[model samples]
Target chain A: MIEVENLTKTYGSYNALKGINFRVEKGEILGFLGPNGAGKTTTMRILTCFFPATSGKATVAGYDVFENSLEVKKRIGYLPENVPLYKDMEITDYLTFVGRIKGVSAKDIKTKVSKVMGDCGITHMAGKLIGELSKGYRQRVGLAQALINDPEVLILDEPTIGLDPKQIIEIRQLIKNLAGRHTVILSTHILPEVSMTCQRVVIINEGRVIAVDTPHNLTNQIQKAARIFFKIEGPAVNVVKELNKVKGVKMIEKKETSNGVTDYIVELEKGNENRKVLPELIIKNGWGLHEMRSVEMSLEDIFIKLVTEEKGVKT
Target chain B: MRNFYLIFKKELKSYFYSPIAYAVMTIFLIITGYFFYNIFATFSTLSFQAQMNPTLAKQYNLLNISESVVRPLFGNVSVIMLLLMPLLTMRLFSEEKRSGTIELLLTYPVRDIEVVLGKFAACLAIFSIMLVFTLLYPFLIKIYGQPELGPIITGYIGLFFMGAAFIAFGIFASTLTENQVVAAVLSFGVLLFFWMAGYSISFVSSSLVSVLSYIALTQHLESFAKGVIDSGDIIYYLNFTMLCIFLSLRALESKKWRG
Candidate 1:
């Protein structure tokens, strides 16, 4: 539903999007994950035809964003980072205004506005002015605004920002519900937001595309340094030495020793399990294996490592 | 055209949604009405003094409706509009930019010209509404005096177009900045400059005289105020309004280029 090619946007000497390329298929929700100032909003703006790309091309719903911007604009619903709304307008009035501009037929505007308002669960606040609603309600109204015309593509930038955790989950669910009908491309710096809500993600940083893959695969790839927390009743030095003897055990660092019990953090080599070997080795040495728990590789870790690491992956 | 209408309706509704439209209308009407009553009061006081003194009766008797009432009313309203139109038009684009709604607007499927026209049309409508209230003065005159409707009609047409011309400039000024105050001041300064330039027609040499008169907006209004209904004056306003509207459109388009 969206294609961006060599999408370079330069502001004088600085590049906001440096020849970045990505695509989203029909009915797929592609999470655009990056840290702040990472060109995610710039990419979304270009796709929505806010401005033409400086040196490249972008297409949405099969029309070039620059050449057929009006058509492209008609097919995509954009929720900007600020979720710009008229504070003075009542919800129904604002939605009606947006509906007409989005090209909903005159007779159908009422029904369409109500439908999106219902979908976003803002039916109760239809009579309130937008300024009177809370952040969460206003955010829902913003979502409803984007969904009013039922466009084929939704370009949402930081949709859940500034909302409470429950509101976040509600918005996530709302977006998840949008997937098999509208192709969704949303930008966020939150990793869990991507893992929980998106089918695929394009990770960008510092104006360049770093990685693009399924959330599952991206997390799995960075789980190579699987870590474990170990507690054994033994001398701390001896526990370290014994764990080193087991193949696939990469490193062990002593954490603490309370009385005779020692706490150690162990790193396991990729694709290998010394988990089975550790219990047998402890029994032979007669040291009690008090507690052993493998640490789950979290998407947070993957995101931090992926963003902090300096390796630039090509396409 | 439908897009223009939709945008125009929203803009027009928005003006009333806040204190802008009402505040501007009230202030404009109060100030212009003061001048209207003041002009007629002077005319009546002169007539009264002339009847009592008999020495000044000839001069006061010549205080006709066209000279003492219609001409000064239009001139006063013109100056009043020059000041008040900026207050109404300043927020047209500046408020959108400050609130960040311009992004949503530009991303909509409407063309740049449509947005410009929509905003200009709405501001013009509000100005016309304000002018409509001032017509009560003429209505009262029609009841009490035998005033020529031709000059009254033509004078109002001139007033409407000139106010509209100011509105076009105001919209262009709005496109220049995000602060409504700055936009208002900038538009006010520009209009004031044109007023000063027109007033300077008396002080300059003959060679520079024609140039200043042409540059002066009031020179274009005099014929319309006298019921001449010159097409040249009509075309001047049309060209001025269109030129400013076109420039404002270019200013909006420049953002894409500047980006």
Candidate 2:
């Protein structure tokens, strides 16, 4: 639904986006993850035709963003980071106005506005002024405005910023519901939001895309060594020494318990599976292995590692 | 055309809902009415045959009837508009920039000209409504005494063109800054220069002085106010308005590239 190639934006000597490239398939929810000022907003703005890229090509719904911006704009609904709204306008009136400007027929604007207001759960406040709304309600109103046009592509930048936890969950659920109907490109600093709501994640840092893949794949790719945890009732010092003797076991750390139990974290070489021999080995050593579990790296760990690693190499 | 209509309607509604438009209009009416009444009272005391003070006596003589009172009624219209136009337009683009709504607006499928024209038309519509109310002065003159209808209509045409020119300049100034106060001050400064340009040109006798007078917006307006429909004067105001709107469009378009 969206394709960006060699997209770059420069402000004098400062390069806000440098040759960033990414694409989103139809009906796919793609999350753009980055820290503050990581060019996420810039990339989204360029894609939405709000700004022209200094040197790049971007197309949305088969329309070039710069060359055929009107077509691109007609097909995409954009919710900027700050949720800009006319404070004096009522929620319903604003949505209707947006629908009209987006080329919805005059006959359909009323129905479309109401449908979006219901979808975003702002029907109750439809008659109230936008400026009088709370942050969460304002964000919902912003979302409703974007959805009023029934756009084929939705570009939302930090859709849930400044909302409370409950509001965040509600908005995340709303975004998830929008999948399969609207191709979504969501940019946010919140990692968990991307992990939970987006099927594909693109990590950008310092004006460049550092990683792009499924959240699960990113974690698996970054986890170089296999680690396992074991709770054993045995001689603590001997258990640590015995675990080190197992083949493919590169390192082991054991913690002694008050009840003569010991816990150990065993690290194995990459591509090695030691669980098959663990039972036999524990029996042979006369150590009672009460609990055993594999430790898998999470998306958070991978994200931190990737961002920090990129930072380290830069310096 | 539909997109322009949508934007125009929304912009017009916004003016009525917000206190900015009402406040500006109220203050404008109060100031204009005060000055009109004061000028009329001072002239009423002078003899109808007094020709020494030609401008003041002529103004009084023109105010005798309702429909022909446009001369004195619109004499102070420019000054009233000078204060109100900036207030009405200060938030046109500045508020959008400050609140980040400009991004949302640009993302729609409307052309930049459509947006500019929509906003310009909305402000012009409101200014026209205010002008309609000032018609009461001309009507009052026609009721009380006889006055020339030709000059009255010409005076109103001049007022409309001047207001259009001022509105365009105000919008251009608004686009240059994100702060409404700064936009208002800058618009005021620009309008002040244009209003004073004709008088200032008198001090200069160089060949450039005549060219500058042609460029001055008030000089063109002065001809219309005196019952003249000069094509050159009409083209001057139209060109000035178009120039400002074109510059504003460029400013808005540059934002996308700078992003």
lDDT of 1 at B188: 96
Top TM-score prediction, candidate number: 1
lDDT score, candidate 1, position A222: 78
Stretches of candidate 2 off by over 4 Å are A225-300, A308-315, B47-70
Please write out the lDDT profile of model 1 over residues A1-315, one tens digit for every residue: 788899999887888988999889999999998878889998988898888899888888889999999999999899999888999999999999899999999999989988888888889888999989888888889889889999999989999988999879888998999999999999987877888999999988889888899988997787776688878997777778878988999988888688899888889898887688888888789998888898866656766788667564333
Off by over 4 Å in 1: A229-247, A252-265, A276-300, A307-315, B60-62, B202-207
* DockQ of candidate 2 (2 decimals): 0.62
The candidate that wins on DockQ is 1
Q: Tens digit of lDDT per residue, candidate 2, span B1-259?
A: 8888888998999999998778877787788777767765554455354466677566644444422234556667887798789999989999999988888898899999999999999999989988887777667556755667887788888889888998999999988889999999999998888777777776787886987788776677767767888888878889889999999999887776553
Model 1 residue A155 lDDT score: 89
lDDT of candidate 2 at residue A313, scale 0 to 100: 92
Q: What does DockQ give for each predicted structure?
A: 0.72, 0.62
Model 2's TM-score against the true structure: 0.86
Compose the digit string of candidate 1's lDDT tens values, residues B1-259: 9999998999999899898898888988899889988988887787778778877776643568778888888998888888888998898899899999999988888899999999889888888888788889999888777788999999999998898889999999999999999999999998888777877767889999887777678888889888988888898889889999999999998988895
